[model samples]
Target: MLIHPEEILETINMVTHEHLDIRTVTMGINLRGCSHPDVATFNENIYSRIMRCAENLVRTTEDIQSLYGIPIINKRISVTPIAIVAESCQVDDYCSVAETLDRAAQQAGIDFIGGFSALVQKGMTPGDLKLINSIPQALATTKKVCSSVNVATTKAGINMDAVAMMGHIIKQTAELTRDRAGIGCAKLVIFANAPDDNPFMAGAFHGIGEPDCVINVGVSGPGVVNSAVRALQNPSLGDISECIKKTAFKITRMGEMVGKEVARRLNAQFGVLDLSLAPTPAVGDSVAAILEAMGLESCGTHGTTAALALLNDAVKKGGAMASSSVGGLSGAFIPVSEDEGMIRAVQRGSLSLDKLEAMTCVCSVGLDMIAVPGDTSPATISAIIADEMAIGMINKKTTAVRIIPAPGTKVGDMVEFGGLLGTAPVMPVHNFSSETFIARGGRIPAPIQSLTN
Candidate 1:
């Protein structure tokens, strides 16, 4: 993991001008040992264990940032899913668990703490149900805590019951946090085929198969990729793809260096380097802009999907070549609110909900950071999750939905969530009803592709 000084010097301009940086350095801490029968004891065990493990995470990241002269945007922690860790506790409500995690994260000086989660892809246990029921309150009460629920998987198919419940849970979370334009929903994600080593927030959790302590990194370089593409004058499609692959290789190498240094300092195992092109609100640093640079007039146009597929494949191939430990959702991300270019596309009516859904088939994650109207029905939201879940289940890829039913907002209105969360223009969903469709709560069997064995 030791990089040469010349290699460090080579990335000076990319760091100084092109917005290439380690998006997140997440420490995964297994909390299975913290489980206890008493609720108070369980909380105490988790809080003490997390504090002991992650007390120096922020400072270590800061030291690495100063030593390497590379910006690390976020230092985060992912614990074993609370549904599994807290099942032994006697408590019915998990809001206290969420608050404990939030306090520990604040005390440790980290950005966010994930693992307020449940895995109910096949069927819900009593503990899973308890954790799921507490999500609305947990997210509403905790600022730095993030939650996710995996309601479907490639092997287990789609769980329509959990899907239906999550729709209602999302609505309730929005209502509880209406003052902030339902920002609580922004911290919640519904997933299908969630990865074990993802470092990004709102969908990150330490999986059961992971080590007791591990370090994972997420790298983003949309601006660098865009610059590479724009540097080529009247290039063919093959030329653009090659340029992206080279740029992605450089970006992933930098990320691996950062991740390994952080792991070494913290005395933790280096897990994986996620080379997802996660964009921000900043101008010129957008995945959508990269697509547009490939000759698309707008992001969600006719040829947009084909362009995105090329970008996604090239990024994966290049990143895989750069690092042997590449994992997570290592592809392009199409989060609407987080990308300024995506916001502009939606504002110009060039991007619609249907188009975004179509693009998710090739993208890293699915239906990310999209805002819909307050009056949208839970059934419609469930239908949306179902569609995204089906895509993941059939394709055997990780997909997720992080949609916000912004309270009191309609189409064309903007809900501003400053700093990384960014602003979202309310996109319109279909007006048709899906009540009966959602009401038939049963498992959608796994696709034929799942029979790989």
Candidate 2:
């Protein structure tokens, strides 16, 4: 990849003005080898392995950031799901392991470490149940550990039992951290069809098939894409899509270069370049702004989904052309709290829980960073997860929910989770109950499309 002077200048402009940056460079470490029959030994093994593998992760990323003058917002690590690695241990509680992970991450100067996770898309093992049970305590105690559970997949159908369990778990997590406005739940996510190479947080994990250690990069440039769309005047929808595609191509190329360099310096394999238009709370750097620039008065209005569909599709197409290693959730993200435009839309009544759910059908992820009334029932949360899972299962795409039921907060109330998590307004759910539906806890069979394989 030869760099021309003009291309360099354009990239600098994007970084300096448009908020283009590598969102995260996650180091995935396989912890399958760290399992042991003794819980104490198991903890020691994982702690030692992480310290050895990621000893220089932070320094290496910092060096690269300085060299290229590109912002790398987070340096993280993803390990094999704890349920798989800790199943061999005798102890039932995995909170101890979560603490060990937190220590390793902090000592190594990492921002966050993912893979405190379990994959129960089909069914839960005894170990999975144990880890799931420990999530509330683990998250409430740890500062940098993130947990995710995959309760449904296109091949395995929906595990309604796990879905129901997570509702209660999330509630417990919130109550335990009520002083912080349920910030712990912000670090936990429930997913359907979770990806192995995702570098983003609250939902990233190292899959069974991944290498021992690899570097995966998540590139975010919603501002650049928004600029491209707004630059076109009196253009057709096709023209808007073409502009997004071209912008995505440049972003992907830059991301791949940075990822490969980071991997090379650390002596790790370069995994994938995720071209997700992840947004921050900053103005002019939002996915919702991109949609509004396409001529909509506000996000979540009619034709919002269609605009999102165009954006997601064009992003994927352009990213695919730029690199064979385009993986993870490579499309536009619509986390309401994280995007300033989305926050405004919610406050102004242009966005709602139902509208966000519908938008998830075409976006990369589902119903992310949402806040609901503290009194919302656990069964209702399960039903919300079930609904998002169904969309991902049917479409064979990745969808997740990171909702906060802030204690003592109601609709129209604001919950502040500063930094990358951002603040969210409490959104309303349906008046009717989904308790009866969620109470019938069993696996929802896979769709007919699963028969293809």
Alpha carbon lDDT of each predicted model: 0.95, 0.94
My TM-score estimates for the predictions, one after another, are: 0.98, 0.98
Question: In angstroms, how far off is 153's CA in candidate 2?
Answer: 0.7
Candidate that would win on lDDT: 1
lDDT of 2 at 36: 97
Which pairs of residues clash in candidate 1, taking residues 3 or more apart in a chain or in different chains? none
lDDT of 1 by residue, 1-453 (tens): 899887666588788888889999999999999999898899999999999999999999999999988899999999999999999888888999999999999999999999999999999988899999999999999999999999999999999999999999999999999999999999999999999889998999999999999999999999999988999999999999999999999999989999999999899999999999999898989999999999999999999999999999999999999999999999999999999999999999999999999999998999999999999999999999999999999989999999999999999999998899999999999999999999999999888888889
RMSD of each: 1.7, 1.1
